[model samples]
Target chain A: MSGLQPCEILVVDDNPGDVRLIQESLKDGRVPNRIHAARDGEEALAFLRRQAPFESAPRPDLILLDLNMPKVGGLEVLRAIKASPEWKTIPTVILTTSMGNGDIKGCYEAQANAYLVKPTDLGTFSEMLSSIQSFWLTLATLPVG
Target chain B: MTQTPAPAISPITLHLLLGDLPGLATCLLGGGGQVLEWTEGAHALLGQGREEAVGRPIADLLRIPAESPLPLLGQRAETWSLLTRRDGSTFRAQLITLPVPEGHLLLMHPALGTPQPKEETVRELMELRQALDESAIVAITDAKGDITYANDRFCRISQYSREELLGKNHRIINSGYHPKAFFTNLWSSIARGHVWRGEIKNRAKDGSYYWVDTTIVPFLDASGRPWQYMSIRFEITERKRVEEALLEKQAELEERAAALARSNADLEQFAYVASHDLQEPLRMVSSFTELLAKRYKGRLDTDADEFIDFAMQGALRMQVMIQDLLAYARLSNTMEGTQRIHLEDALDAALANLSLAVKEAAPTIRRFPLPVVMGDLSHLTLLYQNLLANALKFRHPGRPLELTLGAEREGGHWRCSVKDNGIGFDPQYAERIFTIFQRLHSRAEYPGNGIGLAFCKKIVERHGGRIWVESTPNQGTTFLFTLPMDRSPS
Candidate 1:
């Protein structure tokens, strides 16, 4: 853990408030991490592909995605990441407010690393983010980028 | 002009003429108007046998006045005169004189101011024939299947002249609409001397189609063989048209009803989906307001704290209302989870779910035996939970609450009821209480989103049941519902 660099996390969400709250929650965690935000699924794809303006962006250690959005939805992004040879090794987690059975089943079938419903309670929401940081960033081993 | 001499008469010709006028009395007269022969008909009519009055003068037998001119030898005449019977009784008669080979044949009969019976019979036959021809399309065919008689109505309806119809069979009017078996059955029935009645489609000379209700009667000879067939027909084209139009209208109505049902189902599905999506934003509002109240209370001004509390309360209530709306819409969307379940077990599950409220209220509860019913078990549990929760929420403040749950078989259904000694409402509001979001009490008095009773009603109806309430203000209330014992899959 000492030799490793700070973890880079990418959060993809349409709502700016939700993205800010997630960043604030992850800041309280023990693991050293840097947060990068994409306003929607398209920007997240541009960052992942390192296109033009994002040519110097670092490969994200973990990706958090929202289900419902304006253009491309979370399920399609999950599928795109799992299909690519370069991005498939990076763990992608779905964190959305939809607790519907169909959404949960679809995300899992798309090879999402984990599925979490955004809790309505502020404490529970922060706690869920801390758990994701602890487990995906500190505990689990990943292939080096 | 000079008058021609009359030809001499022969006795044989006079005798043959007597047989011509059947059912009438006749006597032969010589050149002097004396009776030459008294026929058997005359004896029967005038009470005089031939032996008693064969040589009497025609005028003497008829009592004709002397001044009346006698009928001439070559002319025909008729006059009313009196006739004397052999018994000396006299009656008025119609005397007819026709020239014969001898002189004139005088025919006499009692004059009742009407035609003689023989002539009246012939006139009646002619009148009956005219009536049949005017009212019906009549046709007769000989034993060899050739048309022997066709009335004027038959020729008019067939669009053919009388000359063209005679000596021709009915094949000219065949429309070919009926199968071969139909005609075969008709022929066999008529050939067996049975009257056949049916509806037939026929074509006219102008190639127009028409429907007819027909009856054919066979006239048989002494050996029981049919000599001819008479067919009577009435047009039924208008009736057939009306029947066909009615069938088309009925089919159209059925299709429209099916389409309307499909649209209704689509609307219900839309409502369910819309309500489900509405929950996300509502949850965010509620969560943020709570966060504001928790983090800024006492740090902000007193007024700001109070305002945040109000906002939090509003968001929470809206969240509850939207959740209830989703539940109500879901009842219509997923009605397929139905099976046979024990009502007792369902009631137990409801009580278990409301254990906290039951422990807090400490209400006295009684349960009776319940029958097994075919329904969605979770829905039934929800129905019971809502009713029980209502009873607890509306319990009388001063007195201990009492609750009863019971069910019994009634015909093909089980009549189940939940009774409670609570603050009952007015009977007039019973029907409105089951409608979605209809509340009888203010939110300050009783806290509810007013959706429980609506759920109960929808669940019972989906299981082929009916639900209603009976209540008395300030006394008690009973919620009664019926569930069918057996149901076919829809």
Candidate 2:
């Protein structure tokens, strides 16, 4: 605990239930983390840019972006993040309900860190979130923020 | 009655009158039937000189039969008599005698039985010409292609009088619709003395267009060179108009069919997008209900627990049904990854996917050699997996499971079969089973969303094939499908 730093994670999704479930799943993970929720891609971009309401926000160490949402879509947000020199180092993983080959291929081609289909089973879903947290936050060497 | 003093008949005036009666033999005979004067026609018909023919007894020159005697003077008479020529040969003649003041005037027309008289032949020719002129648009052109004659029907159709058409070639009515090559070919054929037939579009005098079906016959002379050409034509403008209208309608129908196909494709795309989007909310419902059941199952009251359980089950089932609907829609939307693959490889992959069920069922499996086919490998794999899964799901509990997979070459395709000793359904439901969400058994008996067979049907059809099942209740089931053979050589 003394050596570890709190990991900041931004979750972009339209459904509040999914955000809450993801938060609950990662509550007891190996890495201590603070989760921020953005209801849409526009808000997610705004938060990443630290504009207005998010002026004092910390740069997220990782992002869990959903493919389908209101306003801008996850792919556009990913491209915007990757294109910006400041936010390009942030590891953005796509988490969505789609298992279509087109969506999978599109996310990878957009340089997503990882693409994961939202599992239907609650236990499997929680395990997936836990693994993502342990691997991206604790194990993988992400850029220092 | 002095007959107006009876103008003295001069020989020159009399000769001029007799010469005007061409193709007839005439002479003046005395009251005693003696030849008094003979015209050139008489000399020509009797093969004798006028000098010798005159002053001869008419009965000696003409062998007049006694039964058909000449009438009395001042009365005209006609009879068929035998005439003697200067050559001493006798021939039949139609003889007519007219009474005159001084003598009888005889007119003779040589008549041969098989060859008609000149007057009759001329009359028959006139009748034939009238019939042809009335029925057809007829025209005669000399070898130089200048119109020599135009019938009334031809003049009416061309809107030209005989004066305007004669000496004019067919170019006056040419519509310029046909290419130069068309006329060139026509002239070449007719010049060679061959009959030419074709449909021609001609322009009228009023600048209107007309179509004619024309046939041209060439008359060849002794040397086999065409001397003249006669063309017979029929008006076919109405038929050509009908044909053009039919062609236009056919083009319009083809355009409409293409538009319909485009609209149908758009609808299919919409269906795919709608079904795909439906799965998102369904996942939230299923995952949350499952989470609720997991987190607070024992902590809640029995009623609450039961309600949560029911919600969980309903959400889970709905999720699966939506996914199945998405897969069905996607089958039409995506048709990539087509390749030549071995059927045995596809079957082996399906067996590997069902490894757990296979181990549990412990079924005896038999496989025969399969042919290489053209298809999407993943789709074919899913097709086989679904069929085998159905067999395992509906296995008869009373007997050990036995399954067989085999294929046979059938013309341009391979007919493959999967036979299973299972709890077969009623034969009536054989067709219904391939429809989505159509189930014969309740969920308690067979746990399925009733999508496997439907998936198999879609996959089979996507590869340009057909799938059907044959089954008998309490007996066994056999599923047969056909796939087109690969066209590429090995």
lDDT of 2 by residue, B340-455 (tens): 99999999999999999999999999999988999988889999999999999899999999999999999899999999999898899889999899999999988999999988
Q: Per-residue lDDT for A1-145 in model 2, tens only? A: 2247788899999999899899989988878889999999999999988987899888898899998998999999999998899998999999998887898998888899999998877889999999998888767876564
In candidate 2, residue A139 scores what lDDT?
Answer: 77
Q: Write the per-residue lDDT of candidate 1 for residues B434-463, one digit (tens) a residue.
A: 998999999998989889999999889888
The C-alpha RMSD of each candidate to the native structure, in angstroms, is 13.2, 12.8
Per-candidate iRMS values, in order, are: 1.9, 1.5
Off by over 4 Å in 1: A2-5, A99-102, B1-260, B487-490
Residue B243's lDDT in candidate 2: 94
Model 2, position B410, has a per-residue lDDT of 94
How closely does chain A match the true chain A in each prediction, as TM-score?
Answer: 0.95, 0.95
TM-score of chain B of each: 0.54, 0.55
Which residue pairs overlap in candidate 1's backbone?
B9-B101, B9-B102
lDDT of 2: 0.86
